[model samples]
Target: MYDALVVGAGPAGLMYSRVLAAKGFKVAVVEKNEQLAVKPCGEGISARVLKTAEIEKSDYNRFISHVIKGAVIVAPNGKEVIVKEEGEMGYVIDKKNFLRVMGEYSASTGAEIYMKEPVKELTFQKDHWLVKTRTMELEAKLLVGADGYLSFVSRTLGLEKPGERKVIPAIQYVMPNVDVHDPDMTYFFLGNDVAPKGYVWIFPKDGRLANVGIGVQGAAPKAYLDKFIKMHPEIFKKVDILEFRGAAVTIGGMLSEIVTDHAILIGEAAGQVIPLTGGGIHTSIAGGKIAAEVTAKALEEGNLSKQRLSEYKDKYNEYWGKRIKDSLKGLHAIEKLSDDELNQLAEILSPEDVVNLANGENVASVAVKLLKHPLFSIKLARALLS
Candidate 1:
């Protein structure tokens, strides 16, 4: 039996597998797809993710498509607020190559990765799990579910599938040879008409290439994205669609229970995503590292009980749990505002305030700023402060 069986060979599974193997544990990662990063994504990530994943500068540059300075937040009425960071803020990565390198690192540490092998069934027998794939069956002492939003492993764990109320549907087109206003800066468009309850984003990739996408809560995302492209002829005129795909992102906060006896859930399966921006790349990478550390301790002690495994949740919470909760609060507060209110909010919010609020760092500063506006009363400000 293997020390751990990791489902889904995405960044999370591969990362933890690498860590476990490095710690002298036998780990196996099984993936459904033939290749990695086939899922639709904006592929944007902060520099912190690279540090957390322990990738060297040369390897990181291999998969980095663009260096991002910051973003331009546009209001409904066409007003724009430029949020610029002092240095390299983030990167739009070539995710396929990134994941491949991660897998290579994991494999080098003696972790077995099985691709194109979807998990057919999971059976818990005694203290081990019998995982049946399309071609073979394997048994392991622990099961790690790093599978995504529609994770089969999550269902087996008796967790509720992310419902429409908990997820936002997003669609993106890889537009090559497109004329973007600024290739180094990302763009965020905010308006109910533009994306209903969600927002639209234009993240530039390499030269003349961008990922243009729209995420909406209650309507068709592709239709909205297409309409936005048509209306913004200055940006999307003469653009060629190289690829397009749709995906659902879970924004309902992390699940209360992510660990059970001999099993753990990480990545989007457990809602390890930023609720406000639907960003999971960083959080998931961090979570994978934490899960590996916790699981390794449990193995050394010969204890795989739910209580022992629960330490993984505690460590993850200590790291990013509060930030995620705060982001959910920020999302809730902004979702209640009308387009006019958002426009007013944009005018009053400085770039630093936007950064702080999005990161769930300085709520008091933003609350104070909002209180000056008559639209946000003492009650709303208090709500934000709380």
Candidate 2:
């Protein structure tokens, strides 16, 4: 029997397998896809997460945009506010190469990797898990489900639905040859006209290449993406379409029961994506590390029971609970702001506020800064109080 079986070879699964392998655990990673690459993503990760994951800067293809000096916010009325950040700005990654390097690195660490093997069913029998694929059955002492939003392991484990608020739909595209300057500065557009209940982004990868996307809360995403593209003819006119992709982003947060009886859920399957930004790369990586550590300890103690797996929950809560809660609260604050109010708020805050906002700071802090601007304060106060 394998020590650990990770269902999904995405970043989260790979990270877990790599960590466990390093600890001398027999780890196996099963991926449904035939290969590793940018399957579907926004293709951006903050410098913070990169550093935290210990991913080398040289491992990725670099396309410096604006040094991410800060984020620029465009209100529905075309007003703008630029917020300067406190530290090294984040990088827009070449996601395809990033994934390839991650896979290679994990394999080099001695993790048994399998592709094109979709897990069909999971059965818990006599203190172990029997995982059934189309061609074979494997037994493992522990199981981790990192298989994106529609996680089969989660379903098989009988975990509660991630809830409506947790699931978000996103549509994204890579546009080549766009006439955008300061590629390091990420841009966000707020207003129902642009992205109802969600937001639109322009993340530059390099000189003229950008990842443009839109997300909507509890709404069909294709229609909104088409609308966003149609409404921005000026930007679209100068850009060439490179690729298009869409997927669900878990934003609300994970359910209460993330681990039970020899099974654990990580990544999007556990609703670890940032609520406002829909960024999951960092969370997934961190979650994988935490899960692996917990799994390793449980295996060493020869107890893979629910009580032992509870360490994963405790560790995650200690690490990311506050951040996730704060993000959800901030999303509520943003949701309440009217289009004009949001535009005005964006225009009033400095680049620091923008960075803090994107980095998942407290909404009250952002509110206080906006209150300093008379017009924005009035608009925001009315929106919040009403």
> TM-score for all predictions?
0.96, 0.89
Could you tell me the TM-score of candidate 1? 0.96
- Top-scoring candidate (lDDT): 1
lDDT of 2 by residue, 1-386 (tens): 89989998877888888888989989888888887753567766667776656677676444324345556777889877775556856777766566667777778888888888999878888888899986779999999999888888887777755353366678888887654445657788878877878888888766677888888876777787777777777667767677888877777766667898888998877877778788888888888989998889899999988888999989987857556656665676677777877766665666666655655655567767767777756644333333
lDDT of 1 by residue, 199-239 (tens): 99999998889998988888999889989999998898889
TM-score leader:
1
Q: Model 1, poorest ten-residue lDDT window?
A: 157-166
